[model samples]
Target chain A: MEFSSKLLEKAVNEMAQLPGIGKRTALRLVLHLLKQPSEQTHYLSQALTTMRDDVKFCKNCHNISDVEVCEICSNTSRNHKIICVVEDIRDVMAIENTNQFKGIYHVLGGKISPIDGVGPSQLNISTLVSKVKMGVIDEIIFALSSTMEGDTTNFYVYKQLKEFNVKTSTIARGIAVGDELEYADEVTLGRSIVQRVPFEISLKNN
Target chain B: MEFSSKLLEKAVNEMAQLPGIGKRTALRLVLHLLKQPSEQTHYLSQALTTMRDDVKFCKNCHNISDVEVCEICSNTSRNHKIICVVEDIRDVMAIENTNQFKGIYHVLGGKISPIDGVGPSQLNISTLVSKVKMGVIDEIIFALSSTMEGDTTNFYVYKQLKEFNVKTSTIARGIAVGDELEYADEVTLGRSIVQRVPFEISLKNN
Candidate 1:
């Protein structure tokens, strides 16, 4: 779209560079910023720039943090020996929300997607290998999504750690707790059946 | 959602303040920015802040501009005596794209909407009236949308300019170009029939 002012056009173009935002949406957002008080735009710009300049990652988990190490990684009560491998910081937040896992996380930053030109070397895999090689970890859990990229990353990391004396396991795949079994996909249903646990074991967990 | 980093949370919150963007979408956008190079974030922030701090509005028409007077308002070829009143710069851009109207525009900035707490005084209505009172303007066309607020704004402006000698009219309300008659709304179809133009007049325009 043609803009009357170069400044407006530049702002909209920059906003459109973001994923999922188009030129029209960028224009709308820029116009919204224009309509509001100048302080609103200042705050947004300041926050974004500050975050980009100062944001840090946990040295141990590779998750986003403001300090040298994240709270979960530094917490003495949690079991740091059991590392939960995941895609990004979002996954760490999701797992933390469940309050089920007491283990620390190892953020891979992203999955290994060759189609997108992202290889194993691009991710935070080397540090994780070194952590495992230190022989302080007891168990490693693969907590990535169920996509093909997730499986590929899991297998690649598992192969890298095979020579080392580390036990690796994947998160269980099953129908959602509130979902009907009839609606479950065939592959997931079949896997759930094959991986069924003992009746008493399930009772003991409850 | 819980964020490990305060800076990340602040950025996400600021991004979410934009219209139509929720917390989840904001988080996704902020994280995407983090994944990209620092220059991308710098450019985006700089553009938005510079636009907000330096952008100007045309003194005559109140359209967004970088100069004291907008290009359209300063153009000698366009008819200055005839003014088309619109809600915002987007409408100005839309009309300009059509290449039909040779008259200048007066952007109202917004329509009178009680629900949104927008009144005529808040918009650029006074300047338009003063321009009309100068006796240089021959005609004033109401080109706001056909919504209730648009109609209210049109009537309000019409009343304000009643004492002046300038002729007032509204943009025609009818079925859109290439729209099926069967699918047309009842009010618009009825208005189209009632305000039907002469057959020769339509032929001459084509």
Candidate 2:
């Protein structure tokens, strides 16, 4: 017989289904919660059910937000001339934590993974095109994953925005900064070689 | 501004309020739950609510249970004549894992600590005394913490049951079975010396 109640067993099973949480860890969490007072446990239950309720995605940037336009998109202080396009809201938070970029973000929901049947139509493309056509955009920094699908997504977005007079640049995928050449992975070395920049060709005196 | 919603914040707050959990850890847990599917989150919510609703304290031992009598108490295979008293259900679990003892358990709920305002009346002592008086008990072992309060509790219980003719013993407080003498703590060494057996007198070859 289980040490916990069936309800706890069910809850533990659900928690175990989450990314990286196993059944043992789930049991520990349930047991810990059980030791606490009823109000706290009730509050936790309420939050889990109500967290996604009444919450709408930002209509403008596709960031997970309660309002029509995300906070970043609505803020006038943010740079309107540059837009950082990303694959998910998680990336928006990742960039926001850096406190280095003042530009707003546009979430594409996900990349063009053909194996998963995710194509250009599956993403928020019409809105992006409309945003560019409305004119303040000078640069679009594509901060996407280095996966094959992300590259395919970039070309698709690039093709759609080529006519609009905006400079489109994708984040570089070569040897990482501070990496030793001898220990570098083959893929990185090959990409770095393929994307090599040109400078003045020097001839030896000998 | 945080990327989390109000409900998510509430859930994290509830989680952080649990013992040994902090704000950062709660945030990580909330994020993990958010990334999971709705079915999994629903199960976790149901579990939190049911933990209090379904699980009840076992009347026999005060261990957590869904039934009136816990599995251990109801089991006929267990030795009814011996009872091992403990502070909490966790202690019972620790002892059960050993599979060395076949006796029943009596949980004190908590030790007597005047500083915390916990006294004899707060514990399930009346039930324990009644069970002892049933004339079936032959041995009563006290497996408690080595703290001052635990000792005081042990002394009080021992005094209360002095009238009954039963084998009363405490779990040994000495250098542990696998401990290295060089690394033994002073308190453990002192206890071992005081409780020294007649090994030298009885087993001496000379």
* C-alpha lDDT of all candidate models, in order: 0.95, 0.78
List, residue by residue over A71-145, the lDDT tens digit for candidate 2. Answer: 888899989788899988668878898786898888898888889778889898779989999877989999999
Encode model 1's per-residue lDDT on B78-158: one tens digit a residue: 999999999999999889998889999999999999999999899999999999999999999999999999999999999
Writing each residue's lDDT as its tens digit, candidate 1 over A56-123 gives 99888989999999999999999989999999988898999988899899999999999999999999
DockQ of each: 0.87, 0.32
Error of 1 at B100 (Å): 1.4
Q: Give RMSD to native, each candidate.
A: 2.0, 8.0
Model 2: runs farther than 4 Å from truth?
A1-29, A84-101, A107-136, A140-206, B1-4, B113-120, B133-135, B163-165, B174-182, B189-206
TM-scores for candidates 1 onward, in order: 0.94, 0.69
- The true-versus-predicted C-alpha distance at residue A78 of model 1, in Å, is 0.4
**What would the per-residue lDDT of candidate 2 be over residues B94-136, giving only the tens digit for each residue?**
8888777899999897899999889999887778888877778
**What CAPRI class is candidate 2?**
acceptable
